[model samples]
Target chain A: MRWFWFDRFTEFESGSHATSVKNVSLAEEQVHDHFPGAGTMPNSLILEGLAQTSGMLVAEYYDFQERVILAKVPRLRFHLRAVPGDTLIYRAKIDSIEESGARVSVTSHRGEELQAEAEIIFAHLDRHAEQRQLFEPNDFAKLLRTFGVFEVGRKPDGSRIRMPAHLAEAEARYRSQAQA
Target chain B: MPTQDEIFHKVQSALVDALGVDEDEVKPEATLVGDLGAESIDFLDIVFRLEKSFDIKIPRGELFPEDILTNADYVVDGKINDAGLEQLKKRMPFADLTGFEKNPAVQDFATMLTVQDMCNYVASKVDGKA
Candidate 1:
């Protein structure tokens, strides 16, 4: 089963930074299992939300040619616990980007109060070197679209960030298969 | 060759376009990261725009020195040594380092660089001095 940590991206700038939001809800199984009655979101899950926001930013820098994997959390601090009714807003800013890897500063907020802040590093893996596929292309494309990457993303000049031809083709194939 | 005014306008436009900031916000004295709200990722976008606008190739780490922190001779115990600071000032002449001299941490130098510094660097590169 595939897990998406973030609900949708509210802001996306190619090769730069992104902002996403996740709503903590009673419907989430983790909330029910966490305390049975308290209904507090897990701190680890909040970290995942940070990773997803920053990971996509790093991946977009490479034009999605390489697979970006979370390498480490060099620093992390939690100031508050998020409850079921809270809405978590995640903002990730790139610290440095190199050919092999990148670093990002991530912060999660619940209505202006800081919940957690983390510094994350990501390693770029060459797609060809890894024979095994981590994600099916069509599924990944669908995930990107659902995240609002294509809709809200823009270049430095305020122009729309276009989906690469390969991903577009994959999405087309996926749509046709669904229709068939 | 473009005039100084022309170069300034181009550099300012590039920064505005790259960082998604207003034209007035990208002043010569504004620090790119602190004042103009440029993230590390935005540096690449700014460089790309500069290259296309001016028809010049900016090698990695040339516009912004990336290797200074990793070099043992320049850094010690997370702080940039005096010699290293001098070397950095030499490389990035346009940057305002008056405050950085008091206590120089390797990590903090990038944030100290201002938009005017970048514009000057671009001018130098175009003039064949870089």
Candidate 2:
């Protein structure tokens, strides 16, 4: 509910797309007992990884007050098992947005391989209320500020990805860090 | 606050609830791989259960070498032996969740677990029939 699984928003574009990453480590307790000798990264968390990443996109669309939960996972598949040391890159492209909830097509990749993919539907809920809240006054500025919308990424060759104009300055700074 | 043994027992019971494996299958000495035959996704579902049950995050990391990850025997061969289990048990931090603010995933690993811990986690996630 708190988007506890993923962190570090590398690329966040307003009104369209987003990308986030979760670094997996071997020291995890689940790794030790998971299979004794063959501790593997769990898929649900990988799904959680994707959900948390995409959820951030949806969460950013609303102000921080709303908690986004996966109402339905219409389609999801695990192509591979991501291990520790693997950084899961979650990318979500918004298919549509409605008043009650929105739909997102999410992809989870471990480097080049598509680790998992899902079509997720998220319902927006108020933090205080038991049921979901229908709407809130739009806050584009707060979404950009809280979600670190300035950070951006590039292709291997160094061309910048598509992003909003306001984030251009932040993008330049991020590119410097990415290069460094 | 639950003592280590109590925590261990609670974890064991949770595994039985989730995975449905016999309690004897999840003893401290049991191997999660050769003894239990859990797949990777099974491990994930189990962790979610443990998190839900104990209210914790299992610290994550890259443990196995890249070449060995997909191999079935690596887990069954006791690659992470009792010595490793002891090291894992020692690493379970009793610190507050606030310590995890630096990295939320760290909360996932607060409890030092044995193969039994993994079993309980796996068991708790499943319908408790396996």
Candidate 3:
């Protein structure tokens, strides 16, 4: 099976982070089978959304090597039911990357409303069943160019932080939200 | 030589057939969940299709406590460990063999999927560390 939920990547960085989007619709049949009458997007899929976003980020780091899958999900939570007509924006950042594995944090949003969040860890191995290895950085620069980079964190004063150049506009957006 | 483009095209063909959508609609730009309307179960089916089509194993995992993010944060990181492979080696009830060829899930909103969902499922079944 594959992670088919992440539309395509809107932005990506091999070693740092990535971003993608998903547009949910009422026409989705899973909604009907899940609740019958109400038919809400399942929490598992929501998590899948996060995993896929982060998985690709990890894959880009590997230059789409063998393949990246969820080895384990240490934590997950669903704050609300995502119904049709909601466009979910997924963002993921690398917390750390090592030869054996990597860890990442993912967040989802619907027009500024905090929808979901998760932390993911991934390991890379060959399809031939060899031990895990460090993914290739062959496409790192090209991939990074495709998806711009951003800075995330908070200032000492408890204000949010942003990148100086790449994400200047995004930084302003987040800061504005912080003030609001 | 097996180029990435070949593999990508194969993946795309499986998606087009399994989802019953137009091949043009199956571009890399398409989002499985958002654009395709795929859900978890449907995603499982897509995995089965890809495995049969590509003859590969896909790593699979579920949510635990430490990986929770907000709803919009759909980023997960993990390699399909030994445990995950064992689970997938077992029967996959989520997949349906009957309507696979015609893309029973296509345009049905009942069955489209994002690319990542399909990839992870395939990753779960892969025998990466054997």
Candidate 4:
């Protein structure tokens, strides 16, 4: 099974904010049997969607170089549960970013109504975990490409965001290694 | 510059939000980790909130000097030596090191910060006394 919670990015602006959508469907086993009878999207999964939305945004700030992890959700308030068939639109905006980590304020909306609002803190593994590889650079870049980040992503000046060459080079290296 | 009460209030709010503790629980002498149940990750969250609330730039290792504690020159057998204690004192005058000076065990360092100490730090930063 995949850990993808959100479907795709509709708006992705570099160093600022991004919006992603998750369609709750009863076809998903968890939603169908979340309460045995009620077909509702689990709150935890909703939080995952929110996290992914913000995590991707934070990772892009460094061209996906830093090992960014969800450190804490300082604030998360849910107003209502999103049932299957309801689309949860997650909006994540970077509050601050520094060498230590970053803070993002996010909101999940069902159409025009707000479902949840959260303040998420992501910590970069810059200190002790510097020597460890949190993820394969190629897989990471491919995931970002699959998520349509480059398609909708824009720089601060409204230019299209480009994929980092290092990540692409890492992928090319991996492909050559496999072919060899 | 913000007054003492103003700084305290802001610090209190930041701790409350970051630690998910009650406003009444953030006493002047309450230790952040021991009294408020803050974890290592919470410190990062608290720092960001404090920075935002006070509109101040809190450089890493300023509020908490984990580096000094981890440094080999300062730590020996899980205890902070005299040099380490002195470095901590010089960097963190906002914190009262009298209690921590007795043992200077690196393990017990997390319990050193209090609500009032945080307020003092913010005050010093705002008044340019730090």
- The best candidate by DockQ is 4
Instruction: Choose 2 or 4, whichever is better by TM-score.
Output: 4
Q: iRMS of candidate 3, one decimal?
A: 12.1
Show where candidate 2 strays beyond 4 Å.
A1-3, A126-180, B1-130
The TM-score measured for candidate 1 stands at 0.58
Local accuracy of candidate 3 as per-residue lDDT tens digits, A11-52: 655567767878787777776688888868777888887887
- Runs of candidate 3 exceeding 4 Å displacement: A1-3, A126-180, B1-130
lDDT of 3 by residue, B10-94 (tens): 7677666545577777765467666765444344445445655667644443311112221123222423333332332243323
Relative to the unseen true structure, what is the C-alpha lDDT of residue B37 in candidate 2, on a scale of 0 to 100? Answer: 54
Give Cα-based local distance difference scores for all models: 0.83, 0.56, 0.55, 0.91
Top TM-score: which candidate number? 4
Cα RMSD of all models vs. native, in order, equals 11.7, 20.1, 20.3, 1.8
The worst-scoring run of ten residues by lDDT in candidate 1 chain B lies at: B40-49
Alpha carbon lDDT of residue B105, candidate 4? Answer: 88
Estimate, for each residue in B48-113, the C-alpha lDDT of model 2 and write its tens digit: 445556655443331212223223433334244333333433443222223223333321332323
| Best-first order by lDDT | 4, 1, 2, 3
Which tens-of-lDDT digit does each residue in A1-180 have in candidate 1?
A: 777888999999877889999999999999878988889899998998899899988888877777888876657899998898899999998866777677788999999899999878687775666676557888888888889998998887899877877788888998898999
Candidate ordering by TM-score (highest first): 4, 1, 2, 3
